[model samples]
Target: MRIEMTTLAEQPVAGVHICFFTDSLEPSGLGVHLLNLMRWLNPARYEMSLVCPDTPGGRWLMERAACVGAVVHPLTVRDRRDQASIDRLYHILTSERVTIFHSQVGISWEGMLGLRIAHRAGVPVRVVTEHLPYLLTHPGQVAEHRETTRLAHRIITVSEGARRTFLERGYPAAQFICIHNGVELPPERPLGEAARVRQELGVRPGAPLLLTVARMTWQKGHSTLLAAAHKVVARYPQACLAWVGDGPERPQLEAGARALGLAGHIRFLGQRDDVPALLGAADLFVLPSRFEGHPLAVLEALASGLPVVGTRVCGLEEAVADGETGLLVAPDRPDELAAAILELAGNSELRRRMGQAGREQVAARFTARAMARATMQLYESLLCEALGRTDGE
Candidate 1:
């Protein structure tokens, strides 16, 4: 017997061409989210292309996107306001016959510029995703937000908290959509060598292990985590804290850990591809972000069957489901953070229950398929409205 498979290119699509632009493809949450979106989106319903900066990270993104059947392009967009860059982007938009231009607004200055170029190119629909909410206190950021909002046909926020912030600041209510970030559920059985991985990380076989996977940036609250680690070790001498991911604050954070005599108990593991195994070998997951825009790490931790202890910030607030799946503490409060970690650490039963609850929550609400479906629905709505306007014309 012979079987035939339909490739994405051979399928009839909705004829809506969308080009997604990003700053770089560094191994960040945004990159991971984008990759998942490309993979899950119904290729039979729309055409997709990804444009990123011409850099190593951009090349990495291109390769990943290509693997998922997305057409990828790398462009040299050095400055947002540079006429040359704008001209190049405009040319690409026109040449590709792009119907919609989608991007994340705040991360790359060129994103806003791309929106303007798309508008000028007469693209019927333009969508921008806001992954982080900017404070209204900053006049410059507020101005930039307004400009980006005016240029886009719609704005997508990763959480309701982010949407509320923008609405309160006078952005049009109808223009915003809150779509929570999602993750693929972990395997039914743990995939990695849990015990061996823990031993390699210098964690004892039977000691409690706490894991945090976040860039060492000020916004991520590493300083507060370090302080909390000090209190954790004092209470449980055998406990070990592993810090994954790297950033500018690594030196300072490492120094703080040493200053507090936590060098032995704290391990800076840097970035690793084996995140699932890391979570499996751990007793709990902690995220001390001062703020967030629907962190994928929390969802991954939940899916990994690990109880999360994160700051009571926007996205985390929704992800944690406080007291159900995990605990939430005030941002920047190391003492409170320490107390929460200890609360989970001391009780194995509580940890196990919370972990089970978290896994259930992720499976129920936050899956990569859900995120892609919501996005595609939004795209269809805009495309229909565009068609309606053209018919009236």
Candidate 2:
């Protein structure tokens, strides 16, 4: 089906309506993805309607979102039907005349159903953003992914490393694109006064400070990072580690730290919104996650000009240039991780150089504007292709 063009008071637009069908817009990576995209998109050219399950955060955010002139539709989703999300999504597509459908995390069974619905409604195109390597998530979803990709006009991956995983899983390269996760850069961060944050964190001057910003989960590799810190402190006794997030795995990880006699060396700061300031005080940043697609924390670290040390996993490899921008070691290797951290912590030159290099990488390729521009261009291309129009003539 061809998308209808809309006429405004002064100009005409392609009349593209985007429908982001997700389970909910709670405090998660996918929610962040939705909000960030809405923030960066060109409002004059595109219209958006977010279809999600009812979530918290009051009318403050929703009211503010409406003030900006986008539509938010709440859904009462039930996961028991034959692709109920997909079925409901079809109704929304026809109702809103959506030109694009974007879904996050894994392919929702209902999400695939929705895509099929939109396609059948003559919406012309569908899009899916894979935030993680999902080839191993569920066998049925994997099959659905194949079918959806075959039907979709385009597919987006958060990282190049993740794109490779999809290709390995037999996803067609012809329809795939890499639009790395983009975040709004704070206008100005006075990284000067670290005294207050440091005092609050209870670290004396010249004490080696290491920081991590992630949820407490098995994939985050907090357990292994803690083990690495144990050996790190054994070599450099004054070193300390601070974590800035909480999750289901926190209690168990805390117990493991106690068992390893690292209770004092590690500080669980829970969740904090002072990440920008926290990155300023830290000497080194570390994220030894076992798996990832594109970690926003790593991006924040690099943007803050902190030297990051993470594992050689999906998405990370795309942002961190091995031994150039940041150090990448094999996951679950506390010994190698410890050595890499020691190398950065002990040498101020390597830390400064890598930190500078990391910042340059972020500026060059990972800006929010860049990500949004590429996404809009892709959406337009898909729309145009479905409309039987070639680029510009």
Candidate 3:
């Protein structure tokens, strides 16, 4: 379904009109989380709308949201001080009679302006979901984060670690809720699909295949992975690393791989749609991220029944049980990262056991349906409280 514009008079409000706001312009994990919520939230009870930048990246997300029956509003704000954009957003909220204004924050203060505008618009419920663990050291950002905590009726963190980070920062513990991010578990791949993916990537049969699906950014620790890959290739000459996703650091990462004589061993596949097939063909999954907020990549890997090897940081640590579903190493430690990869690559049985455990963990706790149900409960509770206040008044 394409995003079609209609007049406010033509489209009468039904159910709860929830407006989701984000400043992010790219199709990142935050976008994925929004899509999952929109796709799973019951259309009969919740009406979803999105407010994002009007750039190409934002349009990419808007199209998908429209496909899932979410109304799309494209607005671009240069920063928190963009008064014109803020005014436009306020108008949208008031005109749409938005019942809930929910903002998704990827970084500090990314969506705080929307929260403030929502409050000014007199929305019944104002919610903000912090998709990353708080590590704000800058004084200005810290102050803004505090303001966000004060403005939002409820703050959702993607992982417990993220909520704890806010708590440690002295935000009210009761205002925060940890809702671990979830994934749509794909059905088993058809026979021969994995082999087809392997052949396309030129990964020879019997060669150790390690897969990593993350944007090529410093936060994702692609350089550290390359360092570890240098060591990994020494042990297994034919080992292949299929790096998925693309970002600003891609050129530097490609140069680093070539400089380290790993050009042949690592394939920099930029943003592929066929990730499930790649995960199936690979023997091990790795994400040496410096930090995360319940990363979708690791969950997708686990759901695909591939063991993971990730850094021992907040979000990653929470998703992976060390020595169980996958191995965890200290961030930026190339030697330790390489050792973990070697350990998994050398033991086929261990990988199998860990992969099975990971799949079970995702099925039991990390499905998108579970996430949507919990979030819907929170929305309904807030709505009930709002109704009570209105009645009492």
Candidate 4:
């Protein structure tokens, strides 16, 4: 399965063929980032492909890749160490003569398997982006993660916090790079769009509409938000809490919301494609995660011109300005979270000012174009070094 290295001239006429490896094609922060990369990367310089499990859940991602003219190769990998799965991946990488293998590490074990297969198949460059800094909290993962870092040509992290965490776990600091996630600046929603979203959510005019777009999970601190929602409802009876994504924690979260007497005020919208429109219709945005890897949702929220109230954690700390764009309170502190939410919810003038500042912040530093350019530069440098090519040569 070893692939012969090609000289720069012998490379694909289209460009370097890079395969982005993932476990599923579900709509995730990483998936959205890849979709953005596919759209923004220069097609003349790079031929993009996505390698993922061919599950029913991944159909959405396959359709998205097809839309952008990127190739999609789906293989069923039931186990991380499945030899058949590795064989399939090996065949694809070798047959396509993949120049670079880039993987997003949702699960370290699966990512490590992909790297091993790519190495065996003679892929010249292998890269992995670690999205979760806290995955190393388990003592067992330290050795495996350290090995994965060693296997990669370069390890990319989405936040400084994540980089530091990995370095502390014995991964080489020189091998790590922090690349912040970015979001596309969406256009202003039509006036009717906002009104329609509010109407569909059963939110009346002038009511404080608090929006949070996150999976229903413990790490996301839905319970903390639920507790804060109770306090919010007691203060602003007309206020409503709308959740935008779904996960395994739905039933428990729903039960908790009901137990806290917030069933009437909280609405779980599951997953929706109209996040921008929903953000436009909302008064404020909140992210109660215990930790994060530079969430794009915060950037998207800022792009939609909404003030955010996020937990004081890694990615959120970087994205939110304490008193400028929004407020950041201690994680899992319901009272503090509620106080901040109430502060933003009670004052329309503060929300307007913070929202404007947030929009300006996103415009200045968090566009998809900036992220794409930085990533492309990294890719070119790595490729050049590997192929013994110099600038303009």
Whole-model alpha-carbon lDDT for candidate 2: 0.75
lDDT of each: 0.81, 0.75, 0.87, 0.82
Candidate 3, pairs of clashing residues: none
**lDDT of candidate 1 over 285-313, digit per residue (tens):** 99999988889998999998899999999
lDDT of 2 at 44: 79
TM-score between candidate 4 and the true structure: 0.94
Q: Which residue ranges in model 4 land beyond 4 Å of their true spot?
A: 1-14, 24-27, 78-81, 107-109, 137-140
lDDT of 3 by residue, 279-367 (tens): 99999999999999899999999999999999999999889989999999999999999999999999999999999999999999999
Per-prediction backbone clash count: 0, 3, 0, 0
Segments of candidate 1 deviating more than 4 angstroms: 1-14, 24-27, 76-81, 106-110, 136-138, 189-192, 389-393
Pairs of residues clashing in candidate 2: 86-110, 86-113, 86-114
RMSD of each: 6.8, 4.3, 4.5, 2.4
lDDT of 2 by residue, 1-393 (tens): 223323111222367777776553343565666667778888877888776666653233354456656687666343536455545655677767666777654423435655555556666667887777754577876776577667677778898888888788777898888899877665456645677887788787788889998889888999888888878888777777999888889999899889988888789998676888888889989999998888888887888888999999988888788888779999999999999999888888888998888888888888777888898988888766666677775
TM-score of each: 0.91, 0.87, 0.94, 0.94
Error in Å for residue 163 of model 4:
1.1
